[model samples]
Target: MTSTPLPSPTSTSGSTHRSPARARHLLSKVPEVTVWFWLVKVLCTTVGESFADWVDARLGVGLVATALVFTAVTAVVLAVQMGLRSYRPAAYWLTVVVLSITGTLYTDILTDERGVPLAVSTAVFAALLAVVFGAWWARERTLSIHSITTTPREAFYWLAVLVTFALGTAVGDGTLELTGWAPGTAVLLPAGLIVAVAAAWRLGLNPVLAFWAAYVLTRPLGANIGDWLASSRAEQGLGLGTALTSGLFLVAILAVVAYLTVTRVDAPGAVDEPGTR
Candidate 1:
């Protein structure tokens, strides 16, 4: 039998050429949701929570004042982010970090300043999150982060994110109060729950459901880690202090965002097909 000629390398590369239109479309949007996205997000939230505490507690800014500062900063960052036509990782992640800090402070204000119990705060935030989700779903007809292409969707996305952080803070703190666990031990519950959620998703749970579940869980997971790292030894922590813990995670988030910006690692593309779990 005659041997068939092997295809040339040039031909193989040419066959893989993406149309300019497709390339442009991909470049003009946010990246497909991935593991890296979640990992960095958790780190950012951790930094936001710990750093806010550090500034208020160690630096003596006070909770209310620090909350006000973060609120202003978050507003400015989000405004800039909203003006962009496409997702930029640095901008997107910066907005997230700010929102995380602001959201945490919002819950703290309720629980600490207003003297609301953690359970009450948790219930209130959870209800608020539900309301945001309802509005987002009603307006956009889609809640998947994978389809965050329009201004309305992005707005809703950020709003939902803010609520999740606030809710997570209340829940995590409430759990601690109920169980009376130290910081180190407290980390395990949320972390374990998130792992279980991931496993369930892999086992064919609804993608949207899984995504939101994991998203909400990460706030507590990250917060616990931050607390465990930053609190004093008397508090059953590693004693890095909030300032150092926050600074470390912030630096890591910044480094990752910079890399993603340059590489366009998370940029959206048509290749990212939406999937049902």
Candidate 2:
């Protein structure tokens, strides 16, 4: 049999290269990973914790019912996100906000509503997140969030995100329950952990791995912040009502998103491979 010679790396006809526009297109759905991204994410997580509590307590809808309401809202926003060809700051962050609330509610449902052990819920969510990542990698061969260009990738991305939020909630609250630590002191744990992860990433750790590690840590960090803000003085929190805490974080998130929208600072070409989800 005759042997066929392979084309060189520079050969255009031998393979395909994404056009600049196509490259932009593929990167359009997800925001760049940046300090701003992390700031806004933590804000979202904080809002998720406080807002869910406010709704349930104020409406008297109970945990499960409150979760269901956020679930519906998340579904609607996620649909809108999936429909967009390019990133719209409002739509994209709205999805995250909803997912954050829904995911927190999910963990609460297991631990508070169903009497499930926080350890069990933590393990379950961790396992589920692992499965999602495993399947996503098995098919796509990459877990990097920067490549969230296609519908399937976006789906996997969102699934992983939801599970991470749930897992973070479980682990964070579980630690609090086990240690009986005050919320004030508890916030330091996750915050310190994230700083370590960031340091590792800077010190040559795999960016994707570091990114995800930090992403998971942010959940607890933000949750703790929310708890510290919303809990009463007796509970070692700031005594801010859930409504006030939620509003504060929500406004902060909006301000950041607006800045990003106007500056396109989180756009695809804004930075190198910096997408969080």
Candidate 3:
């Protein structure tokens, strides 16, 4: 794979880049987009679904309480992440894992506790995501993850990410509700759609659009996968249990993150595109 040196931290041209407060440039707060990036992302999303469920069911904490706990954790983790001048795999992925759980919990709260219909939850989150993207693009003039060098851009990026997770959860669970498909069967749709998106991306669809589309689809894909693994055989799952599934995926994520950290292969400037590397 060919490698390109990462652009200067403040090299990106934009109105947001001119801020005096941002004069001291920061390294890109996000990792370079690569295959490893996507793999760990799906893994984290799976953990988000399984781990959140395990904690809720095993601890007997009410859903709202669980959401509150994770919300608090997310704030602390994100603060730590934001304080760093560059990406640390451990800190960045930790923030993502926590954000995933919190976002999933948010959707679950609306659906299960508030008695909101799945379709309504889906629509609401979709609209919310659009609003976030609209605001982000209007302010930053770019939604490309690679350009997240400023504090405001990073803030907007994380906000969009949280919405994507919540939106994905609602869309995933909602699909199951509306289709009445078993957990295993429900996984196929998102998987197929993701492949389609990837193909479109390689065929000249915008990379930013492609990335976010795949990102949102991954939530459902990962969640359904977690459901398939944890569900009982009667539920057309492997019966691994949510606890076991979460443990296995968490280990997988740790292994991958450690590799990325040590090798710095997914670090900024390592690889620009998947096929190139």
Error of 1 at 196 (Å): 1.2
Two-way lDDT contest, 2 vs 3, winner: 3
Per-residue accuracy of model 1 over 62-149 as CA lDDT, tens digit each: 7888888888898899899878778778888888888888899999988888999999998998899899989976765666665555
After superposition, the stretches of candidate 3 with alpha carbons farther than 4 Å from their true spots are: 1-24, 272-277
Ten residues in sequence with the least summed lDDT for candidate 1: 1-10
Q: Output the better candidate (1/3) by TM-score.
A: 3
What are the RMSD figures for all models against the true structure? 9.3, 8.9, 3.6
Q: After superposition, how far is residue 110 of candidate 3 from its true place, in Å?
A: 0.2
| TM-score of candidate 1 on Cα atoms, chains taken together | 0.85
Ranking by TM-score: 3, 2, 1
**Local lDDT at 47 for model 1:** 83
- Against the true structure, candidate 3 reaches a TM-score of 0.92
Of 1 and 2, the candidate ahead on TM-score is 2
User: For candidate 1, what is the lDDT?
Assistant: 0.75
> Candidate 2: where are CA atoms >4 Å away?
1-27, 272-277
Q: Residue-pair clashes per candidate, as listed?
A: 4, 3, 0
